[model samples]
Target chain A: MTHASLALESALRQVAAEIDAQFDRLLDVPDDPRADLYRAMRHAAIGGGKRLRPLLVFATAQLFAVDKSCAARVATALECIHVYSLIHDDLPAMDDDDLRRGKPTVHKAFDEATAILAGDCLHDLAFELLAHEATHADPFVRVELISELARSSGPAGMAGGQMMDLEAEKASFDLATVTRLQALKTGALISCAVECGAILGRVPHEGRTGLRGYARDIGLAFQIVDDILDAEGDEALVGKKLGKDGAAGKETFLSLLGIDRAREQARMLVDQAIAHLHAFGPEADLLRDVARFTLERDR
Target chain B: MTHASLALESALRQVAAEIDAQFDRLLDVPDDPRADLYRAMRHAAIGGGKRLRPLLVFATAQLFAVDKSCAARVATALECIHVYSLIHDDLPAMDDDDLRRGKPTVHKAFDEATAILAGDCLHDLAFELLAHEATHADPFVRVELISELARSSGPAGMAGGQMMDLEAEKASFDLATVTRLQALKTGALISCAVECGAILGRVPHEGRTGLRGYARDIGLAFQIVDDILDAEGDEALVGKKLGKDGAAGKETFLSLLGIDRAREQARMLVDQAIAHLHAFGPEADLLRDVARFTLERDR
Candidate 1:
């Protein structure tokens, strides 16, 4: 591996460890009936997945020299949202997946009711973290962070995208429709992670243009890569069921563009994503690596 | 009816109209697949229920002369959390109720996926509303409101209570366990509505003691009344299934304390709730009425 890959890998490892520790300290099991809910939450959120969202927040926050503790808190909040989405998505009513992160899903391990409550609890915890003063000394900054996270994750953003994706199995979506769906489902939160970092750094709205562009491009590339993986990647490496879209006869980037063309599209988008970072110096080296990593990641 | 009951009735009518108008404006159906999600949210949230949570906020905020529009937004946010909880609680994996507020539940009106997404989106919108400057001019006030709402609505509060309530179906709970469960589930948000009003009014910690006490008493009274209604209320009057707790063999206040005793307990609690308003003058008249309404409400 190149030095850049090594740097990204090390950062990923560090973030996963930090996030696990934070969740551990935050979600202690009480000697009450709610213990099962906490356990389900810990099961789903504590030790799992790529931790890509948190890594994006940290990488972007590093560019502005934001405090590590503040960045860590923000990262944890992002992870909370991401993990909660995963828990809800894995429910029997939704995707009906029995496994997540190579383990039994929350609904399968615990009952479906506990899983739903656990997901709902984690959802609230994300906003709670962002709204607190510990995330930022300036209440103005904290409020903005909360507002941005709320917008990206709400009906018009991430949830809207999920709604559209659920519709995709029924409706035949063209490239433009697929692009819009991917933008809402996966791109919104990915872009918000970078936007939140800018908010934490007190980057003015005008100052975020480049970062926003980078996030958007990489967000699309990330989805294209996801479609490719879902079509062709190994389930063991992916840590869940694969080719689900194909099995469901769903339209995906792979189905529309074919594997070779989808790969090319993702590559081009990643290159454009890196180009959006022209103004940043070596301080943004990690973000540049993230864009490339989006294309190169196997799962 | 007495003059005081007339006053409370007028206020309830006004607040219900205001809440419906506010929800109508906030949840417009977008011209996309997510339209179903927004429609489901509207079905669950608007044109239904007693709107008691918003009344609590308005009543409490009125005491300190907070801005009406500001109070209105906070009330809506609280309602969003309440409605979201109802949507999730009514899911097939949870209570599995088909009817709510005399209408089909979201999952029944739409599909389960849309219902889940609607609930999640509404959850996000609550924080989004609180975090926005339109809710309050003071960032300090806004952040505090968000934190409090997050705390009351999340795992350690409403959701945690819900988990315990689910457990109640399997395990035999005593009076204390039932009280704790009810406090977490129903009382937390009701209490939060009052507390949020205090926060919005910038009432100091020392000044809010009476209000907190009033809220706590009324919250429990509200649940005791619910237990009473569940055991004996008419299906048309209650607007949903009756005797669910007894049918499920779930332990409740009515199960522990007999009907005469439960009604007596609720009446005592209502009187206690009214006494907490001794520090305020006639401006607190509505709060006193709400406490009385708590015991009298059959639904």
Candidate 2:
């Protein structure tokens, strides 16, 4: 990796660790015997990952001169949604995967029923966390964050995109169809992270729009890179089983377009993602770094 | 059966038809081609068994001298959540049931993946409908409805109960455990329907509390009657396969207390459910009727 990329990774890791610590404080389980469910949910959520989504929440808030700590609930809520998706997607009824991030998947580590209930509980916790705001400087800003996150993670957003991807499996879909699918499946949450951060940061409407554009390109580019890695990356290095996309006969970007074209498309998306950050000037340097890293990451 | 019970059946059937008609008008397909998903979702929701949940919503709103139409979106949303649960419970990874309400389960009629996606989409759509002002008289009321529904359906609520139910399967559970599980799984939504309607109607807090107590008893009685029927009712008469609970080795009130004792307990709960409505005078007549009918139903 480049020196600049390594530094970006280090900074992101530190910010993510801080975010995880905040989440641990927030998840104070009650004394009820049923509290085991809460323990399972926290265990799945706090387990380590890149924490890219929460970092976006923190980074975008910093860009608009907001206190990073003030946005912890929203960032934690965003990660809860992401973690819930992972839990449900790995269920025996769904993807039925056994490994994720080099650890046993939630269902494999616990039980299928626990995993389902865990996902359901986490999904609700995300909204509850947003609704029960404790630190927002402005109540209306919190409402904006809640409403944006609700819409982004909801039917017209990430969940909708997932259903579309399920339908698109092994089916021939046009570029437009694929774009629309990815825009919701992956792009919606990414865009919501930035939008929520900007709202909490009190960014103007124009800036919100610009940051959303940046998130959208980077989100799609990130997925394309994922598809590329799945086709070629080593299983031991990537952490999870690779080539499952091919085995599942998924309609991935790499499958739709040859590797060279897919790589070229990813690069173009990274460029566009960075261009949208021009409004933030040097304040968005880390965002640009992440966009470049999206296409450059080996795993 | 009894002449009074026959009259109750006619009233319930008429109410179900009216509620189904209203739901039909509200089913709008988005412009996206994935709109079929919403359509299939409606198929799982409408054209099912008795609209008991919606009836509770309308009946509870009526208790506050509010128009049933005032709670229509919330009524629909409650039913949406109920239907989504049924679909998910019928999946191959869960109960793996082939029939529900005398028809093929969603996964049996549709594909498993579609059933899963439909259930997921329905959950989000329920919230979306509640969030929209077109469904309710006031925005604040809609928000209240959304919050109440989430509380009833989420982790510490219905989903929590579902986990207990899964755990209870193939295990010996005491009456306390069975009751707690049933209260969460079935009683949560029933109580929520009644309470949410009162909130939408802007009923006084004390009256809302009384109505909720009334609904809770009715929910418990309803489940007790279901347990008895599972042991005594015919598959054809019940409109679904009977003996399912026993076949699955599920721990229910009947399994804990035996048939006669369970029936006696149900009668007591029904009486208590009706007695709680005494404070409401004539406004709570339909709720009384529902409680009575729930206890006396043969199938």
Candidate 3:
């Protein structure tokens, strides 16, 4: 592997460890009936996924030399939202997936009620962590973080995107429609992760255009690659049910453009994402690598 | 009715109208797949219920002569959290209720996935509303409101209480256990509404003890009255199916204390709740009436 890719990989692991440790300390299990709820949250949140959102937070925060501990808390907050969405998404009323990270889904591991409450709790935890004075010395920064996360994940963003995805099963969606759906669903939070670090660094909103552009491009590429993997990747590697979109007759990039063109589209997005970071020096090499890693990841 | 009770009645309508108006404007539907999601949210959020939380907020905010618009926004934010919990709690995986507030539940009105997304979105919207600058001039006040709502609604508060309530179906709960369950479940958010008004008024932590006590007593009394209504209130008047607690074999204030004692306990708590506001003179008349109205409410 190239040195840049290796650095990205190491950072991924490090962020995952940081997030896991934070969640461990944050979600200390009390001896009560809520213990099961906490356990279910830990089951879904503690040690899974690519930790891509947290990685983005750390990478962008690093660009501004924001304090590591502060960034860590913010990163963890983003992951909590990401993980909470996954738990709710995997509910029986939604995806009905039994396996996530090769382990039983929260509802399957615990009960459906516990799964629901765990998701709700994690969502609340995300805001709580962001609003905490410890997340930033300035309350304005903290409120901004909370608002950004709220906007990105609420009805107009991630959850809205999921709503569109569910609707896609019944209606044919053109590429524009699909793009809008993807942007709201996965793209919004992914972009917010990058913006949060800049916010923590006290970067003004106007200064964040390039970073926002970079985040949007890579978000699309990452999602396109996700579709590609779902269509062709190994189940053992993916760690969850795959090819369900095709089976459910959902409209996705892969279905619209086919494998070859979808892969090509992802490649172009990665390049465009990197180009958006042209103003930065070697300090941005990790971000450039992250865009590349988006299309290259197997899971 | 007495003058105080008449004043309480007028404020309830005003708060409900204000809350409904805010939700109506906030959830303006766009023409897309998410239109259904937004519609579901509107159906659940824009109307119905007693608007108890919002009333609590406005009443308490009135104590410090807080700006009405600011109090309205905070009250709306609290209602968003309250409504989101109701949406999730009514889902098939949870209470599985078909009706809420005399109408079909969100899951019944829309698809299950849409209902889930609506609930998730509403939860996100709560923090979004709180973090907005219009909620408070001071960012510190905004962050405090966010954190407070997050804590009360999260696992250790309402959701945590929900988990315990779910567990109660399998295990017999004693009086103390039932009290704890009610405190966390129904009590936390109710208390939060009162505290939020204090927070908005910038009431310091130490000065909030009496308000906190008032909120807690009323929260308990509110739950007892809920249990009482569920046992004997008319279905048409109550607006939802009643007596599910008995069918579910859930241990409640009624089950542990029985009807006569439960009634007596609720009366005592209402008296105590008013006593918590003893230092406040005539300005606290509405609050005292609200405490009295808790046990007197038939729905």
How do all the candidates rank in terms of lDDT, highest first? 3, 1, 2
lDDT per residue for candidate 3 within B104-141, as digits (tens), equals: 99999998888888999999999999999999989999
Q: How well is each residue in A132-186 modelled by candidate 3, as lDDT tens digits?
A: 9899999999999999999999988999999998999899999999999999999
Tens digits of per-residue lDDT for model 1, B253-283: 9999999999899989889989989989999
User: Which residue runs of candidate 3 sit more than 4 Å off their true CA positions?
Assistant: A1-4, B1-4
* Residue-level lDDT tens digits of model 2 in B1-299: 33235545676776677767766875666776466666667678777677888888888887666665667777888887888778877777667788888888887886776677677666766766766656665555665676678778876678878877777775677888889888998999899888887887888676576787788898999999888888888777677677878988887898888888888998898888888887878667778888888887766
DockQ, per-model, please?
0.93, 0.30, 0.94
Query: What tens digits encode model 2's per-residue C-alpha lDDT throughout A194-240?
Result: 88888888877965777888899999998898889999987766667
Q: What is the lDDT of residue A299 in candidate 1?
A: 68
- The lDDT of model 1 is 0.92
Shares of reference contacts reproduced by the candidates, in order, are: 0.95, 0.17, 1.00
What's the lDDT for residue A249 in model 3? 91
Overlapping backbone residue pairs in candidate 3 total 0
Q: What CA root-mean-square deviation does each model show from the true structure? A: 1.3, 3.2, 1.4
Error of 1 at B189 (Å): 0.3
TM-score of chain B of each: 0.98, 0.92, 0.98
